[model samples]
Target chain A: MWKTVVRRLIIMIPQIILLSMLVFTVAHFMPGDPFTGIIDPNVDAARLEELRRAAGYYDPLHVQYFRWVGNALQGDFGRSFAQKVPVTTLIGARAMNSIRLGIVSTVFTYAIALPFGMLSGRYNNSWFDRFVMIYNYVSYAIPTFVLALLFIYIFGYQLQWFPTRGSASPVIPKGTAPYYWDMFYRLLLPGFTAGILGTATTTQTLRNEVIDAKTQDYVRTARSKGVPENVIYNKHIFRNAFLPIASSIGFIFSGLLNGSVFIERIFAFNGMGDLFITSITSRDYSVVITLVLFYGVISIIGSLVSDIVLSLVDPRIRIE
Target chain B: MATDNTLIEVNNLNVGFRFGDEYYNAVEDVSISLAKNEILAIVGESGCGKSTLATAIIGLHDPHNTRIEGEILYNGLDLTKLNEKLYNRLRGNDISMIFQDPLGSLNPVMTIYKQIEESLIYHTKLNDKERYDRVLELLNQVGIPKPERVMKQYPHELSGGMRQRVVIAIALANKPPVIIADEPTTALDVTIQAQILDLMKDIQEETESGIILITHDLGVVAETADRVAVMYAGQIVEEAPVDVLFTDPKHPYTRSLLNSIPNELHEDGEELHVIQGTVPSLQNLPRKGDRFRDRIPWIPDEAFDEDPILHEIAPGHKVRGNSWKYFHFEGEEME
Candidate 1:
C-alpha cells in the first residue's frame, strides 16, 4: 500500500512540472505585464530595465521557470503583482479557510448522500424514493448559484436563522463556546448550499447502483442462505453498491476544494474563490497561477487517496 | 430436527407472474414429494420452468408480484402460508439452495469462509471457533485442498469448479434436510461436472438428506438422480424412477429427449434428431391444450387428449395426457 502511494506521488512530479510550464508560458504571453501596474512613468529607460532584470522578466523562459519552480518548492510562489505581498502569504490565509470549509462540506456531502442514497435505492418506487428523485431533479435543474441565492434569501434574509455573509461574526472571540458555535452557525447557509450542490446527481446514481447491485446472483445466494433481508441489503448489496460510489471520490474531493466558489461569492466569504475572482480581474498572474496549481495538487492527491480506499474495500483490486 | 421419512412435499403448485394486467404462469400445477436420501432431478430444456419450480418450492417468489397456488408442505406446515419471518427460520436451517453460475453465486467481496459461515452463524448456536472449524471442515468435505488458505480468498481467486465447491460447502454447512441444486453443474467443465456429481452423491449418502437436483442434462440425472421428472413448457410431461423412465419412457417429449443423445455409433455429420419448435413464451401460452402439442405436430390428433393431466399408468410412474398408444419419432418407435 505504501509502495502504491509512493509510486503515485512519484508520477505526480512530472505532471505538476508539465502543468506549471504550460501556465508559465500562458502567463508570459498574456495581454499585459506586471511591471505596467507599477511602472514609473518618470523613470528613465535604464531604471525600467533595472526593475525588469531584477524581476527576472528579461531572462530566458527556461531560466525563469527553473527559478520560480525552485522557489515554489521551498514554499515561495513569488510576489503578487497587484498586492505587492508574497503570493504564498496572500494565499495561505485564504487557503486555510477554504480548506476548513472543504473538509466540512466533503464530510457533509457523503454523510448525507450515502445512507440516504442506499435506502432510497433499496426502497425504490416508494413514496420516499419518488421524493428523492424529485429532489435530484430540482437540485440538478436549478443552477447551484441560484440555489445559493435562494438559500441566502430564505434562511439568511427571511428566516434570520443564519448569518447571510462572511466567515464569522465579529462579536465572538477565538476558542470560546459562542465563537465555535457561531462559526458553525455562520457557515450554515454557505456550507449547506455548497454541500448540497451536487448531491442530487450523486444520490440518484448511488440509488441506481444499489438497485442494480440487488439483482446480482450473490445477493440472491445470500437471500437463499436465510440471511435476514436487512443483513443481505447492508452487508452484501450495499458493499457492492458502494463501489460505484467509491469511484467518484476524486471528483467529490476536487469539488470540495473549489466546489464552494459560487457559494463563497454569494456569502461574501474571503476564501480562495473570492481571492481568485479579485486576482483575475486585477490580472495578478502570480496569484492566479498559484491557485490553479494548488487546486491541481489537491485533485491529484484526492485521486491517489481514492485508489487506496477502493483497493482496501475490494481485495480483487489490490492484488492486481 | 424431526427424522420423518418424507422431507419436502410440493403439492399441486402453480407459480405465475403478473405483467401489467395479465398474469402469466411460469410453473403450472406441479406435484412432487422428496423422501430422505432421495435425489429427484428435474430435467428440461431452457426456460422449461425447472429452475422456477425449484425456486418456488423454496419460497423465493414474492406474493406481491408472483401469484402462487397450492402448498409446499414441510414439517406439518405449508411453506406458501408462512410469512417471511417464519420462512427465514426454516430456510438455510431446513432447506438451502446451490445456485447456478458458482462464480457469480458467491459475494465477490466476501471471503469464502465468511460465505460458508453465514449459515452456521444463523442456524447453529456454536461459538465463533466452532463455526470457523465447521467452515473449514465443509471446505474439506467438498474436496477443496488447503482449506486454511482458501478461507481467506474471495470468489474471484478461485476457479469456476472451486467456486462451485465453495457454493456446495455453504449449502451443506447447516446440514439442511433438503437442498435444491439449480443447474449446479451447467457452468462447469465436463470433467469437473463429473467430480461435483460424485461429491454430491457421497455427501447425500453420508447425510441421507433429500436433494432436488435441477438440471437439463440427462447424463447428470442418470449418474446421480434416483428419480427424474421431465418438464416441457411449464409442465412435467413424465416422471418415474430413473431406471424405469430411461427404459420405458411414456411421454413423446421425454422419448425425443432420450433419442437426441449422441453416442459413438453416430457419424460425425449425422443429422441429430432435433425437437423442432420453441417453447411458447409465458404470455402466449396455450390455455386448453397439451403444451408440447405444437412442437410435435406430425402426431395424429387422436393421439393427444384435449386437456392433458398427469395420470399414473404403472406403480410409481406417471405420464401427462396421452400420445396415441405409442410415440414414433421420425418413423422409429421404441416399444
Candidate 2:
C-alpha cells in the first residue's frame, strides 16, 4: 500500500507540471496584464513599453513558463502584482479560513447524509424514505449560490439566528473562548448552506448503495446465520454499503473546495475563494496562477487520498 | 410423514411474494420433511420455487414483501410463527442454510475466521480461543487445506471451491440439526461440484444432521441424496427413495427431467429429449390442476386430475396427479 502511494505520488509529478503549464497559459492569455491597473494612465506609451520590458513581460511564453517553474521550485511564486507581497504569503493567510469552512461543510454534509441515507435505505419505501427522496430532489435542483443566499436570508437576516456575512465578529478578540465561539457561530450559515448543497449526492449515492448491499448474497448468508437484524445491518450491510461512498471522498473534498468560491463570495468570508475572486478581477497573475495550481494539486491529492481510504476499508481492493 | 427421527416437517407450506398490490404464491402448499442423518434432495429447474422453500424453512424472507403461510414444524415449534428475534435464536442454532453462489455468499470484506466465528458467536458461549479453534476445525472438516493461513484471508483471496467450503464450514459451525443447502454446488465447476457434494455427505455422516439439498442437477441427487423430492412449478410432483425415483420416476415431470439428461445409451443420430417450454412464472402459474400439463401437451387432458394432489402409488412412493400413469411420448402409443 505504501508502494502504491509512493508510485501515485511519483506519477503526480508530471501531472502537476502539466497542470501548472495549463494554469499559467490560461492566466497569461487573459484580456489584461497585471500592469494595467498598477501603471498611471498619463504615462507615455514608450514608458509603459519600458516598464513591460523591464518586468520581462515581453519574453517568450516558454521562457516565462520556465522562469515561473524555476522560482516555483524554490517556494517563490513571485509577488502579487496588485498586493506587492509574495503570492504564497497572500494565499497562506486565507487558505486556513477556506479549509475551515470546507471542513465544517464536509462535517455537516456527512452528519445529515449518513443517518438519513441509512435509515431511508433500511426502511425503504417508508414515509421517511419518501421524505428523504423529496429532499434529495429539491436539494439537487436548487443552485448552490441561490441556496446560500436563501439560507442567509432565512437563518441570518430574517430569523436573526446566525450572522449573515463574514467568518467571525470583528469585535471579538483573537485567542479567546468567546472569539472561537463567535467564529463557530458565524461559520454555521455558510458552512450549512454549502454542506446542505452537497448532501443530495452523498445521500442519494449512500441510499442506493445501502439498498444494493441489503440485497447482496452475503446479507442473506448473514441472515441465515441467525444474526440479529441490527447486527446484520451494522456488520454486514453498512460497511459494504459505505464502500462506494468512501471511494468518492476525494471527489467530495475537491467539490467542496470548488464550491467555496461562490459560498465565500455570498458570505463575504475572508477565505481562498474571496482572495481568488479579488485577485482575478485585479489581474494579480502571480496570485491567480498560484491559487489555480494549489487547487489543481489539491484535487490530484484528493483522489489519491480517497484511493488509500477505499483500500483501507475494502479488503478486495489491493493497491499493489 | 412425521417420523420419530424427523428433524423438520413442512405442512402445506405456501411461500408468496408481493408484486405491486397482489401477492403471488411462489411455493404453493408444498409438504416435505427431513429425517436425521439423511439427505433430502429437492430437484427442480430455475423458477421452480425450490429456493423459495429453502429460504422459507430458514425464515430468511423479507416479511414486508413476503407472505408465508402454513407450518414449518421443528421440535414442536412452528417456525413460520417465529418473529425475527425468535427466528434469530432458532436459525444458525437449530437450522442453517448454504446458498448457491459461494463467491457472493461469503462477505467479501470479512476474514474467513470472522465469518465462521459469526455463527459460533451468536449461538455458543465459546470464548475467543475456543471460537478460534472451532473456526479452524470447521475449515479443516470442510476439507480446506491451510486452515490457519486461509482463516486470516478474505473471501476474494480464496478460489470458488474454497469459498463454498468456507460457506459450508459456516453452516456447520454450530452443528445445527437441519442444513438447507440451496443449490450448494450450482455455482461451482463440475469437478468442484463433486468435491463439495462429497464433503456435504461426509459432514452429514459425522454430524448426523438432516440435509435439504436443493438442486436442478439429477446427477447430484443420485449421488448424495437418500430421498428425492421432484418439484414442478411450486409443488412437489413426485417423491420417493432416491433409487426408486431414478429407476421408476412416477410423475410426468420427473420422467421428462430424467429423459432430458444426456446418457451414453443414446444412439449417435438420436436427438436429446428436451422438456418443452419453461417453468411458469409465479404470476402465470396454473392455480389448479397439474402445473406440468402445459409443458407436456401431448399427454391427454383426461389423464390430469382437476385438483391434483400427491397420491401414493406404492409404499414410500408418491406422484402428483394421475397424468403420470397415462403419460407417453407424442410419437409413442400407450403401453
Candidate 3:
C-alpha cells in the first residue's frame, strides 16, 4: 500500500510538469497581451518592443514555456505585471482564505450528510426518507449563485444576522481574538450555502449506497450473529457506503473552488476567486498560469489522498 | 426416531411474505425436532424452504414483509415469542447458525480471529486474552493448522474449505447446544464436503450438541444425517430414520428424488432421471391437499390425502397423508 502511494507520488511530478506546460501554452496564446495593458501608451515602439522582449513574449512559444517552467521549478511563479508582486505571495495569502472555506464546508458536508444518509437508507421509503429525497432535489436544483444570493439577503441583509460582504471585519483589529471570530462569522452564510449543496447531493447518493450495502451478504451474516441494528449500520454498512464519500472528497475540493467563483463575486469575499477573475480578464499571464497550475496540483493530490484513505478503510485495497 | 431430550422443537412453522396486498407462504405447516447429539438433515431441491426452516429455528426471518407463526420450543420456551433482547442472549450461545455460501457467511473485512471471537465476546465472560487463546484452540479444533497465522487472515485469504472451517469454529465458539447449518458444504468440493460432514459429526459426538443440517444433496444426507426429512413445496412430505428413508422411501417425491441420482449401473453420459417441473413459487403455493400433486401425475388422484398431514406410517417412519397408497422404492412396491 505504501509502495503504491510512494510510486503514485513519484509519477505525479512528471504529470504536474506536463500539466503546467499545457496550461502555459494555452494562456500564452489567449489573445490579449499583459505587456500591452501594463506598459505606458506614450512609450516608444522600440521601448515597448524591449519590454516585450524582456518579458520573453517575442521568443518561440516553447522557449517562453520552458523559461517559465525553469523559473517555476525554482519556486518562482514570475511577477504579476499588473499587481507588481510575486504571483506566489498573492496566491499564498488568498489560498488561506479559500482553505478556511474549503475545510469548514467539507466538515459540514460529511458531518451532516453521513448520519442523515444512514438514517434515510435504514428507513428507506418512509415519510422521512421521502422528505430527505425531496430536500436533496430542491437544494441541488437551486443554483449555487442563487442560493448564495438568497442566503445573503435573508441571513445577511434582511435579518442582519451576519455580515454580507467580504471575509473579515474592517472594524476588528488584526491578530485579535475578535478578528478571528469576525472572520468566521462573515463566512458562515456563504460557507453553509455552499456546503449544503454538497450535503444535499451526498446525503441522497449515500442513502442509495447504504441501501445497496444493507443487502450484502456480510450484513446478513452480521444479523445472524445477533449484532444490534445500530452496530450493523455503523460497523458493517457505513464502512462500505462511505467509500463513495471518501473519493468524492477529492473532486469536491475542485468543485467547491469552482463554485466559489460566483459565490465570492456575489458576497464580495476578496479571495482567490476574485483574484483569478481579475487576473484572467486583464490577461495577467503570470497569476493565471500560477493559479491554474496550483489547482491542477490540488486535484492530483486530492485524488491520491482519497485513494490512500480508501485503502486504509478497506483492507481489500491494501494488497491490491 | 424417539425425540427424547429435544433441544430445539419447531411446531407447525409458517413463514410468509407480504407483497402489496397479498401474502405468500414460503414455508407452511412444517414441524421438526432436533435431539441431543443427533443430526437431522432436511433435504430438498432449491427453494424448498429447507433453509427457511433452519433460519427460523434460530429465530431469524426476513428483515421485512415476512411473518413467522407457531412455536420454536427450546428449553420449553417458545422462541417465536422471545423478544430480540432475550433472543440475543440465547443466540450465538444456545443456538447458532452456519450458512450455505461459506464466503458470504463471514464478514469480508473482519479477520478470522475477530469473526470467531465475536460469539465469545457476546456469549462468554472471558477476557480478551482468554478469548484469543480460546479462538486459537477452537481454530485447531476445526482442523485449521497454524491457527496463529490463520487467525489474522481475512475471509478472502482462505479457501472455501478453510472459510467453512472458520464458520464452524465460530458456530462452536460458544459451544451452543443446537447448531443450524444451512447447506454448509454446498459451496465446497466433494472431498471437502465429506471432510466438513465428518468434522460436524465429530463435534456432535464430543459436545453432544444437536445439529439441524439443511441440504439439497441426498448424498450429504445419507452420509451425515441420522434422521432425514424430505421437503417438497414448503412441506415435509416424508421423514424417517436415515436407513429407512433410503431403504423404504414411501413418498412419490422421495422415490423420484432417489431415482434422479446417477448410479454406477448407468453408462457415461446417460441422461439422468429428473422429477418433472420446478418447485412452486410463492404466489402459486397450494395451501391445501398435496403441494407436489402436479409433478407426480402417475401417483393417481387417490394418492393425495383429502386433508394433507405429515402421517406416521410406522415406528420412526412418517410420510405425507395418502402417500402410502402408491409408495415404491427403486421401482419395487413395498409388501
Candidate 4:
C-alpha cells in the first residue's frame, strides 16, 4: 500500500506540471494587464513599458511559463503585482485558514453523521429514517451560498450571536491568542453550515448501505448462532459498510475545498476562496496559476490517502 | 424393548406465517421423538417444511409474522415459552444447527478461531487460555489438520469442505446434546459431501449426541439415518426405521419418492417411476379428504381420493395408509 501511494505521487508530478503550465499560459493571455492597475497609469508610456518588461510581460509565453515553473520548483511562486508580496507567502497563510475550516467541518460532519446514520440503519423505514431522508433532500436542494447568507442573517445581523464580516476581531491585536480564538469563533457559522449539509447527505446514503449490509445471510447466521446484536452490528455490519464511505472521504475533502469558495465569499472570510477571488479579479496571473496547481495536488494526495485507509478497513484490498 | 432415552419430544407442532391477510400453516400436527445417540433424517422434496420444523425447534423463526403452537420439549422444558435470554443460553450449548450453504453459514470476515471460540466463550466460563486450547482441540476433532494455521485463517481462505468442518467445530464446541444439520452437505461436491456425512456420523458417535439430519436425498438417509421421516405437503406421511422406509414404504407419496431414485446398479432401465404432481402450496390448501387428490390433477383419481393419516402399520413402522395397499416388488404384491 505504501508502495502504491509513492507510485501515485510520482505519477502525479507530471500532471501537476502540465496543469501549472496550462493555467499559467491562459492567465498570461487574459485581456486585462495588471501593469496598468498597479503601475501608475499617469506615468509616461516609456516608464510603464519598463515596469512591464521588468515584470516579464515582454517575454514570450513559453519563456515566461518556464521561468515561473523554475521558480515554483524552488518554492518561489513569484511576487503578486496586486499585493506586492511573495505569492507563496500569501497563499501559505490563506491555506492555513482554509485548513482550519476543512478540518473543523470534516470532523464535525463525521462525528454527527456516523451515529445518526447507524440509528437510521437500525430502524430503517421508520419515522426517524424518513425524517432524515427529508432533511437530506431539503438541505441538499438549497445552494451553499444561500445557506451561508441565511446563517449570517440569522446569527450575525439579526440575532447578534456571531460577527459576520472578518475571520478575527479587530480589537484583539493581530496574531495574538485572542485573535486566533476570535477567528475560530467567526469561522464557526460558515463551518457548521457546510457541515450540516454534507453530513446530512452522507448520513442518509451510508444508512441505506449499512442496512443492506446487516441483512446479509452471514448476519442471520451470526444471530442464529447466538451472537449479540451489538457485536453483529459493530464487528460485522459496520465494518463492511464503512468501506465505500471511507473511500468517499477523499471525494468529500477535495469537494470541501472547492465548496468553500462560495462560503468564504458570502461571509468575507480570509481563506483560499477569498484569495482565489482576489487573484482572479486583480488578474494576479502567477498567484492564480499557483493556487490552481496547489488544489490539484491536494486532490491527488487526498485520493491516495483514501485508498490507503480503505485498504486498511478491508483486508481484501491490496493497494499494489 | 425400548429404553426411555428420548432427549427431545416434539408433539403436534403447528407453525404458520401470515401472508398479508391470510395465514398459511407450513407444518401441521407433526410429532416425532428423537432419542440420545440416534441420527434421524427428515427427507422430503423442496418446500416440504422440513427446514421450517428445524428452525422452530431452535426458536429461530421471525417473530413478525410467524406463530408456533406446540411444545418442543428439551429435557422436559418447553423451548417456545422460554424468553430470549434463556433461549440464547440454551441454543449453542444445548442445541446447535448447521445450515445448507456452508459458505453463507459462517461470517466471512471473522477468523475460524474467533468463530469457533464464540460458542465456548458464551457458554463456558473458561479463561482465555483454556478457551484457546479448547478451540484448537475442537478444530482438530472435526478433521482439520494444522488447527493452528486454520485458527488464523478466514472463511474465504478455506475450501468448502474445510469451512464446513469449521462449522461443525463450532456446532460441537459446547458439546450440545442435539445438533440439527439442515442439509449440511447440499452445497458441497459429491465426494466432499460423502466425507462430510461420514465425518458427521463419526462425530455423533464420539460425542453421543442426537442429530436431526434434514435433507431431501434418500441416499443420504440410507447411509446415515437410524430413523427416517418422509414429509409431503407439510406433514409427515411416513415415519419408520431407515430400512423399513426404503423397503416397505406404506404411503403412496413415500413409495413414489423411493421409486424416483434411479437404481442404475440394480434395475437396468425398467422405467423408474416418479412422484406424479407438485406438492400443494401452503397458501391454497384444499379441504380435508379432498386435499391430496385435488392437488394432484395429474395422478389418477382413485389412487388419492382419501387423505391418508400417518398411522402405525407394524411394530416400529408408521405410514399414511389403510390396510388394503402393500408394497410391490418385481410385479408381485406382498400383503
Candidate 5:
C-alpha cells in the first residue's frame, strides 16, 4: 500500500507540471496584463514599456515558462503582481483558512450524511426516509451560492446568531483561545452551508447503497445467524454500504474546494477561494498560477488518499 | 416422523409477499416436520417457494413486506409469533441456515474468522479466546486446510467451494438443532457439489441436527435426503421417504420431474420429457383448486379436487389432490 502511494506520488509529478503549464499559458494569454488597471493613467509609455521588459513580460512564452518553472523548482514562486509579496507567503495563511473550513465542512458533511442515510435506508419509506428524500431534493435544487446567501440573510441578519462576513475579527489576538473560538463561531454559517450542499450526493449514494445492502444475501445470512438488526447493520450492512461512499471521498474533497469559491465569497471569508477570485480579477499572475497548482496537487492527493482509504476499508481491494 | 424426536414442525404455514396493497401467498398451507438426524429435501423449480419455505423456517423474511400466517413450532415455540428480539435468540442458537450462493451468502469484506465468530458472539457466552478456537475448529470441520490462514482471509480470497464451506462453518458455529440449507450446493461445481453434500450429511450425523435441504436438483435430493417433498407453485404436491419418492412418485408434477432427468436407458433420439408450462407468477396464481392444474392440462379438470389437501396414499407417503390418481401424459392411454 505504501508502495502504491509512493508510485502514485511519482506519477502525480508530471500531472502537476502539465497542470501548471496549462494554468500559466492560459493566464499569460488573458485579455489584460497585471498593469492594465492598477497603473496610473499619466505614467510615461516608455517607462511602462521598460518596466514590462525588466519584468521579462516581453520574453517568449517558453522562455518565461521555463524561467518560472526553474524558479518554482527552488520553492520560489515569484512575487504576486498586485501584492508585491512572494506568492508562497501570501498563500500560507489563506490556504490554512481554506483547509480549516474544508476539514470542518467535510466533518459536517459525513456526520450529517452517514446517520441520515443509514437510518433512512434502514427504515425505508418511513417518514424519516421521506423527509431525507425531500431534503436531498431541496439541497440539490438550490445552488450553493443561493443557499449560502439565504443562510447569511436568515442567520446573520434576521436572527443575528453568527457574524455575516470575514473569517475572524480584527479585535481578537492571533493564536489565542478566544481568537480560535471566534474563528469557529464565524465558520459555522459558511461551514454548514458548504457541508449541507455537499451532503446531497453522499446521502443519496449511501442511502441507495444501504438499501441495496439490506437485500444482499450476506445480510440474510447474518439474519439467519440470529444476529440482531443493529449488529447486522453495523457489522454487515454499514461497511458494505459505506464502501462506495468511502471511495468517493477524493472526489468529494475536490468538490468541496470548488464549492468553497461561492461560500467563501458570500461569507467574505479570507480563504483560497477568495484569494483565487481576487488574484484572477486583478491579474495577479504569480499568485493565480500558484493557487491553481495548489488546487491541482490537492485533488491528486485527494484521489490517492481515497484509494488508500478504500483499500483499507474493503479487504477485496489490494492497492498493489 | 415421531413427535418425540421432532426438531421443527411447520403447520399450515402461509408465506406471502405484498404487491401494491394485496398479499400473494408464495408458499400456502405447507405443513412439514423435521426429525432429529433427518435430512428433508424440498424439491422444486425456481420461484416455487422452496427457498421461501426455508427462509420462513429461519424467520429470515422481512416482516414489513411479508405476511407469514401459521405456526413454525421449534420446541413448542411458534417462530412466526416470535418478535425480532425473541427470533434473534432462537436464530443462530437453536436454528441456523446456509444459503445458496456462497459468495453472496458470506460478507465479502469480512474475514472468515469474523463471520464464523459472529454467531458464536451472539448465541454463545464464549469469550474471545474460546470463540477464536471454535472458529478454527469449524474451519477444520468444514474440510478447509490451514484453518489459521483461511480464517484471516476474506471471502473473495477463497474459491466458491471454500466460501460455501466457510458459510457452512458459520452455520455450524452454534451447533443448532436445525440447519436449513437452501440449495446450498447449487452454486458450486459438480464435483464440489457432491463433496459439500457429503460434508453436510457427515455434519448432520455428528451433530444429530435435522437438516432442511431445499433444492431443485433431484439428483442432490436423491443423494443426500432421507425424505423428499416435491413442490409445485407454492404447494407440496407429494412427499415421502426418499427411496419411496424416487421409486413411486404419486403426483404428475413429481413423475414429470423424475422423467425429465436424462438416463442411459433412453434410446438414441428419444426426447426427454419436459414439464409443459412455467409456474404462474404470484399475482396470477390460482388461489383456489389444484395449483398444479394448469401445468398438467392433459389431466381433466373434473379429476382435480376443488380444494386440494395432502392425502396419505401409504403409511409414509402423501400426495396432494385427486388429479394425481388419474394423471397421464399426452398421447398415452389412462390406466
Candidate 6:
C-alpha cells in the first residue's frame, strides 16, 4: 500500500510539471501584463524598467518561467501586482478560507448522499424513491449561483438567520479562536448550496450503483443464507456498491474545485477563485499564473488520491 | 435429524410470475416430498421451471411479486404461511441452499472461514472459538485440503471447484436438516463435477440429511439421486425411483432426455439421439392439445396433440398417461 502511494506520488511529478507549464503559457498570452498595472503614465520609463527588471519581466519568457518555477519549488510564489505582497502570503490566507468551506461541504455532501442514495435505489418506484428522484433532478437543474442568491434572500433577507455575505463581518475582531466560527458563518450559505447540488448528483450516481449491487449474486447468497435485511444493506450491498462511487471521486473532486469558482465569488470569500477574478481583471500576470498552477496541482493531487483510494476499496487492483 | 417420517411434503404447488401485462405460470400443480435421509433429484431441461419449484419449496422467492399457491409443509409448519422473521430463523438453521455458480454465490470480499462462520453466527449460539473450530471441520468435510490455508483465502484465490466446496461448507455449517443444492456441479468441469458429487454423497451419508438436488444432468441423477422427479413445461411429467426411471421412462419428454446422454461404454459412432424442438417461451406456452407436437411438420397429427398425465404403470414407477400398455406410449392411439 505504501509502495502504491509512493508510485502514484512519483507519477504525479511529471503531470504537475506538464500541467503547470501549459497553464503558465496560456496565462502568459492572455492579453495584458502585470507590469501594465504597476506602471503609471506619469512615471518615467527608466523607473518602470527598473521595476520590471526587479520583477524578472524583462527576461526571456522561458528564462522567466524557469526562474518562477525554481522560486515556486522553494515556496516563493513571487509578488502580487495589485496586493503588493508576497503571492504565497496572500494565497495562504485565502486558501485556508476556501479549504474550510470546501472540506466541510464535501464531507456533508457524501454523508447525506450515500445512505439516502442506497435506500432510494433499493426501493425504486416507490413513493419515497420517486420523491428522491424528483428532488435530485430539480436541485441539479437549478444553477448553483441562482440557488446561492435565493438562499441569501430567504435566510439573510427574510428569515434573518445567517449573515448576508463574506467569510466574516469586518466588525468581528480577527483572532485565531473565533476566526474559524466567523468563516463558518459566512460559508454556511454558499457551502449549503454547493453541498445540496453535490448531494443531488452524487446520490443519483450512488443510487444506480446500489441497484446494480443489490442484483449481484453475492447479495442473493447473503439473503438466501438468512442474513437480515439491514445486514444485507450495510455489509454486503453498500461495501460492494462503493466501487463505482470510488472511481467517480476523481471527477467529483475536480468538479468541486472548479465549481467553487462562481459560488466563491458570490459569497465574497477571498479564496483562490476570488484571486483568479482579481488577477484577470487587474491583469496581474504573476498572480494569475500562480493561481492556474495551483488549480493544476490540485487536479493532479485529487486524481492520485482517488486512484490510491480505489485500490484500497477493491483488492483486485494490482499496483504494478 | 433423520426419522422414519418425511421432513417436507410439497402439495400441488403452482408458481407463476407476471410477464409484461399477464401473469404466466412457471411451475404448474407440482407435488413432491422429501423423506428424511433421501436424496431427491429434480431433473429437467432449462426453462422447465424445475429450479423455480425448488425455490418455491425452500420459500426463497417472495410471494408479493411471485404468486405461489399450495402448501409446503416442513415439520407440519406451512412454510408459505411463515412470516419473514420466522422464515429467516428457519432458513439457515433448518434448511440452506448451495447455488449453481459457486464463485458468484460466495462473497468476493469475505474470507472463506468468515463466510462459513456467518451461518453459525446467525443460526447458532456458538462462541467465536467454537464457530472457528466448526468452520475448519466443515471445510475439511467438503474435501478442501489444508482447511487452515483455505480459511484465510478469498473467493478469487481459489479455483471453481474450491469455491463450490466453500459454498458446501457454508451450507452444512448449521447442520440443517435438508440441503438444497441447485445445479451444484453444473458450473464445474467434468472431473471437478465428479469430485463434488462424490463429496456431496459422502456428506449426505455421514450427516444423514435429505438433499434436494436440482439439476438438468441425467448422469448426476443416475449417480447420486435416490429418487428422480422429471419436469417438463412447468410441470412434473413423471417421477419414479432412480433405477426404475432409467430403465423404464414413462413420459416421452423424460424418455427423450434420458436417450440424449451418450454412453461412452456403448458401440463406437453410435449417434446419440437429441430432443428436437425448443422449449416454448414461458409467456405463451403451448396448450395441452399441442403438448408433444412433431419436430417435423410432415408427421401426422397423432405424433402430437396428446396431453400426457402422470400415471402408475408399474410398481414404484409412474409414467405420463397409459404407459402400462407398452413402452410405445409415445404412439398411443387417442380416443
- Computed on C-alphas against the true complex, the DockQ of each candidate is 0.80, 0.79, 0.55, 0.48, 0.84, 0.57
Tens-digit per-residue lDDT, A207-240, candidate 4: 9878888767667666566777787788778877
Per-residue lDDT tens digits for candidate 4, residues B70-129, read 888998899989987888888888899988887787776678888888888778899999
- For every candidate, the chain B TM-score is 0.96, 0.98, 0.94, 0.92, 0.98, 0.91
Clash pairs, candidate 1, are B303-B324
Candidate 2 C-alpha error for residue B98, in Å = 0.9
Scored by DockQ, the top model is 5
lDDT (C-alpha) at residue A11 in model 5: 84
Q: For residues A1-320, write the lDDT of model 5, one tens digit per residue.
A: 67766776788888888887887887677675646656787999999999888988889889998988888888898778788788889998988899889988898899899999999989889999999999999998999888988988999999999999999999989999999999998888899899999998899999999999999999988998888889889879999999998898987877797679888988999999999999988878768878887898888778877887888899877754
Error of 5 at B112 (Å): 1.6
Q: Count backbone overlaps in model 6.
A: 0
- Candidate 6 chain A: worst 10 consecutive residues by lDDT? A31-40
Docking class of 3: medium
What TM-score number comes out for model 4?
0.88
Residues A157-253, candidate 2: write the lDDT tens digits. 8999988888777898898999999988877888888888899988998889889999999999999898999998888999998998899888888
- Look at candidate 3 and give me any clashing residue pairs: none
TM-score each candidate: 0.96, 0.94, 0.95, 0.88, 0.94, 0.92
TM-score of the second chain, cand. 3? 0.94
Q: Give the TM-score of candidate 5.
A: 0.94
Q: List, residue by residue over A1-320, the lDDT tens digit for candidate 1.
A: 56666777788788777878877777777765547766767889888888778877878888988987888889998788898988989988788878777777777778778877988989989998998888888877888788888888898889988888888767778779988787777766676777777687679878998999988899888878888999998899888888867867777878777777777788898689889889899989878988888887787777877887777677777634
Off-target runs (Cα >4 Å) in candidate 3 are A32-34, B1-4, B264-271, B328-335
Cα-based lDDT for every prediction: 0.85, 0.89, 0.83, 0.81, 0.89, 0.80
**What count of clashes does model 2 give?**
0
For each of the candidates, the C-alpha root-mean-square deviation to the true structure, in angstroms, is 2.2, 2.3, 2.3, 3.6, 2.4, 3.2
- Pick out the ten consecutive residues of candidate 4 chain A with the lowest summed lDDT: A32-41
Kindly state the fnat score of candidate 2.
0.87
Clashing pairs in 6: none
- Give every prediction's interface RMSD: 0.7, 0.6, 1.6, 1.7, 0.6, 1.2
Clashing pairs in 5: none
